[model samples]
Structures are given as structure tokens and as C-alpha cells.
Target: MSLTAVETLNREFLEIRCRILDLAAMLDRLERSDDTVADDPRLKRIHEAIDLLTKSASRNSSSDRAEQVQLTFSRPYDSAWLQNLKVRPR
Candidate 1:
């Protein structure tokens, strides 16, 4: 017999999780390399989008998190400061 709705969803969830883990590992390797092509607009946008997505995911998860965290930031910052945002060269 074919899988039920729940089974299909569960399979997809696992697949997505595995893909995310693989992506994470690749990104980790890229982080160590100095040959990053920051000049590529597509790469730039992808990096920005992923950063936002990760922060959004973290914020949502943190809300229901058991261990409370009170993050403080300087002027012109809020919950966004709670995220580990990229630090551009100053």
C-alpha cells in the first residue's frame, strides 16, 4: 500500500532536514575559504536571504525556548539584535 499523508510529510521532513544539514556543512567549508566571490550579486543576495531566514527561524524557536535569554543592544536595535548577524568590516 502507498504511504498516508502523515507518512509522506514525515518523509519529506526528514529529507529536508538532511539537505539542510548538508548545506550547513558546505557553508562551514566556505567560511574557511578566502576565495569567496562576494562580487557575485546572486551569491550576495543568497547570503542575505539565508541570513534573514536563519534569524527568523531562531527568533521563532527562541520564543518557545525553555531557557530565557535577555539580549541587550545599542541604539537602533531590537529583537534583531538577538540574532547572530554578520559583522561587516568597519
Candidate 2:
């Protein structure tokens, strides 16, 4: 039998909480560092992903949050990616 929403949340709550705490700690560390990340594309993508999650949660949409987040960090596939990276075929 499939688990209900409450049952699923009960099973996963602690893991979810831990992950949020980890993300918060990482953000804190970054804030405390002297290195600048405001202009970094990767950090911009992280901000976009966070905004996506916040918006989706507020809407309570049934979209796949994990897939959305993953896409936020992914790039379009390039047919000449290997050539672009200058990887030699073995």
C-alpha cells in the first residue's frame, strides 16, 4: 500500500530537516568568507533554485521539486561537448 501524505512526511521529516540545516550552514560559511560569489554563475543558479523551491512551496503545486532543482543546475547538452572540452577519444 502507498503511504499517505502525513505518513510520508513523518518518515522523511528528520532527513529533510537535516538537509535544510546543512544548506543553512553552508550559506552561513559562505557569508562569513572573504571570497566574492555574487558574480558567480553557479551561485546565481543556487539562488534561482532556492527561489524556485520557495515559489513552488507557496503554491503547493504537485510539480516534481527535485527535477526542477536538478534542471536549475543543469546545462543544455552540446553535441560537440567532447570537442569543446578537447577530450581525446581513446
Give the winner by lDDT. 2
Count clashing residue pairs in model 2: 0
Query: Per-model C-alpha lDDT, please?
Result: 0.62, 0.92
Expressed as tens digits, the lDDT of each residue in 1-90 for candidate 1 is 999969987879988789889978977887788888668765565566566556767777544322221121114445565454755545
What RMSD, rounded to one decimal, does every model reach?
A: 12.7, 1.6
Per-prediction TM-score: 0.40, 0.86
Residue-wise lDDT of candidate 2 within 9-78, one digit each (tens)?
9999999999999999998998889887888999899999999999999999847999999989998789
TM-score for candidate 1, please give it. Answer: 0.40
In model 2, which runs have C-alpha deviations exceeding 4 angstroms? Answer: 88-90
Which pairs in model 2 have colliding backbones?
none
User: What lDDT, from 0 to 1, does candidate 2 have?
Assistant: 0.92
Candidate 1 displacement at residue 23 in angstroms? 1.2
